[model samples]
Target: MEQLLASDALSDSGKIMLGGAVVGLIFGYCAQQSRFCLRSACIEFWGGQLGPKLAVWLAVFGTALLATQALLANGGLNPQDVRQLATVGSLSGAIVGGLLFGVGMILARGCASRLLVLSATGNARALIAGLVVTVAAQASLSGVLSPLREALNRLWVVGPSTRDMAQHLPDGTGLALGVGCVALAGALAWRNRVAVRTTATAAGVGLAVGLGWAFTAALSRVSFEPVTVGSVTFTGPSADTLMALIVRPDVVPSFGIGLVPGVFAGSLAATLVHREFRLQGFDAGTGTVRYLVGAVLMGFGGMAAGGCAVGAGVTGGSVLSLTAWVALLSMWIGAGAAGLLLERAEAIGRRETAQL
Candidate 1:
């Protein structure tokens, strides 16, 4: 469909941006309605309830895998052209950085995508966290923290060809992974449906993610100018959007750029329709401190990992990328550990209060 649009009156960039915005809108609406958060999913998984949110996430990720791989099989997208982030240093980065990102997400009470949705619905804390994440991301990428990033790269970065999943896997592996994962996730989600509305919302979110990949892949194939062959991932795009706003006027609007704002717009619209829109802020200084630190850690950690939860976990993992799998697993472990720590602390505090 996007290939057919190549000759349309709109420029290639415009088409790309349009596709991104539409996908973002769909995702935002679904996420807001479903309360989809990867951190929450990890915590819930740890708690032993296959929560609706986790089911939704698996379904969403699996949907992306199936959709994207189908495109690759049909030659609609080139695996070579896909954004591959595997490197020698990535192993350490994904584990260490993913842990940091997971912990920060717990502190902030949301990941990058969830924060954007929260900000749209007039959550002041989320707004502040978003701003901090944007700045911290900039600092890590090119500002003060670049040296630290460079040091890590020099010390731990692996050769590019070492962990490339596509190269090592056989011809039919990508297809098998995608199909099997999606089918299994969808079946489990269906069996566990607690509410019809939540189930529908989860399915919608999954479809939106798949469509996002399809849209980008199609555009990349047809565009004459350089187009990023990627789908929905928030960290780099959030940082890039911030930089574009403040310093770089020359930066052209890409799919990620359009997608970020579209998420806000879509979430806002959904909240209004659902009557869930309300101004919210921190109730305590402790929360404020936690969010501040979390934002900083997330900014640096996300960049180090080469992606955030959604970026590496869903989009990259769709193609069975090794770096993404490692990062995703690391994030799960990190979030699980953080959740346990928090729970233990809360339990101790309760005991202390009872004794007092």
Candidate 2:
């Protein structure tokens, strides 16, 4: 039953389970404390007065860049062949998908990444979002929507896989580009340095996360049951993880396969130890409608865009995929649109109410 779970060093299945546990614990603990939420970063920076959100995101962006580049240069591992980070540049899909997801996130009170963090804190609405995300994600992967997704992807397919984009550039050039991007991110974070240390810490934690996944990915190849691996994001991965938990028991949880549950467990444990586990309940109002509707849109957008910001932007982008870059840009643009739309809706509603 546990045959495929062994660590790469030894084909011993027990080691696999142990490896997963250790990785998962670290991931969960840091994520919880740091409150790493990609959606929150975008939304808060744009809508709220939170300055650290961008800093936190940029810090991780830089760290992942330096680490991934160094790893590849030193012959650590190749990120492209991993199917989890497929490179398919569809500009329209990303912008459109991100807009839908962004609006959904606004309604749900979080993006895919934020949902996970909030869920760890016991938010009921997040739990609902998670449930919908998982079911719908599965449907996209292999259920009802799988065929359609595949068909559309093929139809709109414009370029090589994301991983292949990295190959187009020299290693040094790639490394430099990543570093420059991170520097820019660091500059952004500098402004908020005195404000949200938690957000800054989040950046470091996100790096740890990227490394953890990379190792798990490498181990999967040399280990007993090889598993495809990439950065763990809450949106699509939430649904994917749920499906894995249900099926992997009769099946097997590979090294990379186990990290996600580890992420949630990590967060849960942090909540418990820190005495921060808070029960959450949702209110019945337009808020409810917003969350539900947003969740559905997020589900569709996450699938359509291929992954969330953390998934497509950070993980896939690190490898220097053109598709990832395109997706990332498109997402931010869409998110901008969502922000404007929300403002307009509010203004219109207030006007109508005042007239009444």
Candidate 3:
């Protein structure tokens, strides 16, 4: 009875975890229902059909930027002190790592977050891929592969790092945010004019992403314990959650850690509600091999780049960090290059078959 009672009680860390879980739940539902995928976004842009989905992407960045800035202005958080707010690596690292990640993403057919959603919705391949990602991320972060990651990190000249946009562009932070907000709004109005379910879902996701930053920031400010202020990003948190579950660490679960499983649960609930739950797995050995390779690459590349699509593409990009922007562009170019190569190979194969 005593053991049961004790287990039922929630600690301060547990409370924070609960809040993070709620945030993740919203994100998962919105993402699943809306079919949000950074890979799809990139593909659409390449195909010249960048419409509603692209608008949603812009909206996420715009909303996150505005909301985060509001938190900063209202004393909800201190950007300089927050560990996650800082950009870690140099330009060379960002470009190279992002290129690798983008290529890996194409091979995987999804990004980190997408894998989680697919896993919850009965995709066995995504589950395996997720496990691989967790293991590889851990290896790169602190396990045997740490040495390789460190070596690559050291390849470039270590320079001064900036915390966030406000600090980086002290004089033009407001202007930057304003310009970004206007552009995103204009895009949504002009290109995504139709008010569909996807639009609402996108808006919800944008708000949730912003709220994620605010929620973490607010809690970190009042809590006696240390916490990281961040929005959504799946790479590091996948490893963190896996460690917490298997290793039973001394520390309480952070927002990112809690959000990891929450996303799965939320995605599961959403799929169930929508009656879209279906078991999916690799149809052949080649599919298994492809997913494994992609997962490993994404894990290492994401760590090297300091983020995945959401981390650098949405979260960091929203903050107007130059490193994030550079990484995002590199990812775009890499995905485009891979796509073109694949197309050319297919065309060549078709031509050869015709000759035969």
Model 1 clash tally? 5
Tens digits of per-residue lDDT, candidate 1, 1-356, equal 44536557778888887778888898889888877789778887999987666777776676677777777778876766666533353677777778888888988888888899899898999999988988888898899987886666455555546556777778878778766765676676777764667666756666776777777777766678788778888888899888888988776869888888888888999999999999988895456988999898888878877788888878777766677788788888888888899899989999999999
Model 1 quality (TM-score) = 0.91
Clash pairs, candidate 1, are 88-157, 88-158, 89-156, 89-157, 89-158
Which portions of model 2 show Cα errors greater than 4 Å?
A: 1-21, 44-50, 84-95, 158-163, 194-200, 234-237, 244-251
lDDT of 3 by residue, 162-257 (tens): 535456567657546745764765566477673566666755666677777777776666666776678787889888888887898574677787
lDDT ranking from best candidate downward: 1, 3, 2
State which candidate has the highest TM-score. Answer: 1
Model 2 clash pairs? 28-266, 28-267, 87-161, 87-162, 104-294, 134-239
Best by lDDT: 1
RMSD of each: 2.3, 4.0, 4.4
128-178: candidate 2 lDDT, tens digit per residue: 886776677677767897776666556545556433666566558767876
Q: After superposition, how far is residue 147 of candidate 3 from its true place, in Å?
A: 1.7
Show the lowest summed lDDT stretch of 10 residues, model 2.
Answer: 1-10
TM-score of each: 0.91, 0.83, 0.87
Q: lDDT for each of the candidates? A: 0.79, 0.64, 0.73
Q: Is candidate 2 or candidate 3 better by lDDT?
A: 3
**Stretches of candidate 1 exceeding 4 Å from the true structure:** 1-4, 85-89, 249-251
